[model samples]
Target: MEIKFNDVNYKTKLTDINITLNNSKINGVYNYNSFLKVLLNPKLIEKGNITIDGKVYNKYDPKVIAVIDKDMPFYTSKVIDEILFYSKIRGYKNNNIKEDINNLLEKFNLDSNILKRIGHSLSETEKYYIKLIANLIYKPKIIIFKDIMSGMDYKNKKIIKKLMEELKEQGVLIILTSSNSNILYELTDEVVIFNKGKVLINGSTNDIYSNIEILLNNNIDVPYFSLLTYKANNEKGAHLFYRKDVRDVIKDVYKSVS
Candidate 1:
């Protein structure tokens, strides 16, 4: 899923330019279906093309859909049912899909029995839906996760993070772009800064965080924890990354106070 851009130039007037994406990960919860549609039909990539597994996906091809539920009015049961039906017919295992749907239904306190009547059982049907989605993801060397954590609570965000880690471990080239730098840093190993139709920097998350001046110049805000460490370093103090590191530092500070 390596992307190599050669002699690539974009127009200033165009806000969205279609570029070839090699193993690019898209992030967003609502954009799941849209992404899937793009994967299945390459023509949909007119805004941006993706080269996956040696196949060139241009605009108009269906993309991969990473389903994310945000308890929105638009995310109606009917819509979920429809997506499940289509996915099932297309030989997609319905396990994960069904589980996610049921989880959403339970959260909303909706009528779970009604869904069962429509071939969505808590037992077999749920597993089927998950299997269907899993089938869709079979041998996926490149994955695009669109706005995966939008509107997700902390608990749900943790779940998504675990899933992301699993995907990364599976050797899937994951590209996730999000407005939430905290979540992005937590989830992705690499970061690509984009502003006003330009790539400001591409590097590891830690490297990007270390370069606060570059981030500020590009209009990208540093994550809060990174800012905290940066301020401490300015005061000739120790710096750290993970929460545990911060916690350990706090413990040392408490010991000094005592």
Candidate 2:
């Protein structure tokens, strides 16, 4: 499952853009409003071709591409009602919805009370996980999580990363949208960083992070771990690459100094 944008244009906002994203991979699109509206809402996609698996589409399948935008509306008052309704619509028509939903809730470490509460009653993290479960039950070929990691604590971010890893293992085409570079570096296989609504750079995480100058020029913040490592390497003549955990980075620093 690969999605490609071949010289796709939208509303004089985004110029001709070309992108190819493959299956079982997580990619980050670091952009804002105009770009997102055009990507997720196929009604606004125009002036060019958007293809899934190298074929032109008269209509993009909603089931094939799911975008879990943070601002997207939820009609149901109760969480269980909302999840069950959408799940069935997306092809989960089994009679054991309650049992299935409970399993999903447990999978995400969400409490059972989530089913009893209204959408507004849940915290941002709760909302994110529940929405994720709702979308996952649909078995979408491609899942887009919009700004899912922003404002999340490091510990919670780890849990989110694990869930994303599970999605990748399932051979799902995952796209995460965030202006936050820190999350993108750790969470995505590749990243397409946008500058003023155009592609600045789109490459593997290693390549993208290696060029700190480009990120700085675009006003994107480098991950704190990268910064510390860079400073240590520059000032103390220490060599360390940013890892998932700070303790590993510290060990590398110590080894370098010793």
Candidate 3:
């Protein structure tokens, strides 16, 4: 369940890049969607190689990697049709697709009536969830999300976070890219920050986010929690632990004051 990029070069778009990603953790690739393109199509790599579990990714395998991106095309008009089409192609030959789709819709808290509506007519959040279900129906080993948290509300983001945890528990490799640093800090276990087709930092999310100066130097926005923790510790002499939730930091602040 590990994917590696060994000195991968894609024309001038991506320079000599080396990354190792695996299951049991959400991997965040900062401000880069082109990496997703290369993984989806390894032939784009002019030099070096991309591998899954030590094997080169020379061919596309829908069962191996599935992407939930806005750019993913929808051929069918109806939501059900779109899901069913991908399901069939991904090899749901003899399985009860109706039951499966129902379960997926329910799992994501999607309404059953939406299945009959036109795919293009749904809201962005709804469409995203539908795409998620379509991809997850096949149980792909890896899932890549491109700019998924950008426009999402807090509730939908929470849903996605919970879903990611569930996927991690099922041993799926989750690679996500987002402009939002807060989302990345809250959701990802590991992050690889890229700058000008090269990796700036690749480490545990907590470790990377703990350094406010590095993030500021790279022009990446520091997550609020991280920034608050840093300011409290350094500026106010209030020793505080870095936490994903603001409330946890508040509790620490209370403890410090008391």
Candidate 4:
């Protein structure tokens, strides 16, 4: 999605702006207090008027919460509060929002009992809540994860890789961006190199690795087995790219020696 601003004016206390999403006008009004509130505390509430298929929405409607998945409960609660505060203005009526809340909590294996006691770190719980909401709402076509495996140990990383492959098979666009080129070489079909915000190279993992200088410059280390092959190939005056090529070279060397 592309965003553009038009006829924008900013003052110390007042700002008028227009925001376009996917080449359509999504926000046109300016409220300094609301803008400041959002800027100061982004997680306090969900901002911006959302329009799906050209229909403008109040953004606190159940359908809106359903679509956004109430991922940030605090923000959702704020939205609920705002709705209640302006209930007379919007002609809103109270309903059983608890059912929806319960359904959301159930996805994360959370219950009201646990929520009340809440000895766990708020950040961790927030992450779980966000993930649950994201999964519940807007099953996105493309999901990009960057360096998620970096801090994880082997066992946890393996689980993540397996989950990624499963998501890939389910037709989700899974893009894993990592500095660990060896891991990417083992797991991904393609590799893309970025330098100073520009795409330096993009090709099959094997193809990109053929240029060792580019990989080294980008801090992408070659795999250990590949290093072995490099040494063997240098002794025989041969250059090979993929592991299969290296195996064939080794087999040829064995045949000649035997």
Backbone clashes, each candidate: 49, 0, 0, 0
The local distance difference test score of each candidate is: 0.49, 0.77, 0.86, 0.44
Please provide TM-scores, in order, for all candidate models, with all chains considered together: 0.59, 0.84, 0.89, 0.44
Candidate 2 stretches greater than 4 Å from native? 58-61, 88-92, 229-244, 252-258
lDDT of 3 at 109: 84
**What does candidate 2 score in Cα RMSD to the true structure?**
2.8
Model 3, residue 60: displacement in angstroms? 2.7
Better of 1 and 2 by lDDT: 2
Question: Where is model 3 poorest over a 10-residue stretch in terms of lDDT?
Answer: 91-100
What TM value does model 4 have?
A: 0.44
RMSD from true fold, candidate 1? 7.2
Question: Which candidate order results from sorting by TM-score in descending order?
Answer: 3, 2, 1, 4
**Which candidate tops TM-score?**
3
lDDT of 4 by residue, 1-258 (tens): 232223223333223333332311111111123332322233333323333235543233332222112233432233223223333333444464445445555644555453443323345434444443333233343344534444455654565566566656665554554556566666666655544323455556666665565655666466655665566566766554446354665675566456
Question: Which ranges in model 1 have alpha carbons more than 4 Å from their true place?
Answer: 2-10, 13-50, 63-80, 86-141, 235-245, 248-258
lDDT of 2 at 164: 80
Candidate 3: residue pairs that collide: none
| Worst window of 10 by summed lDDT in candidate 4 | 23-32
Give me the candidate number with maximum lDDT.
Answer: 3
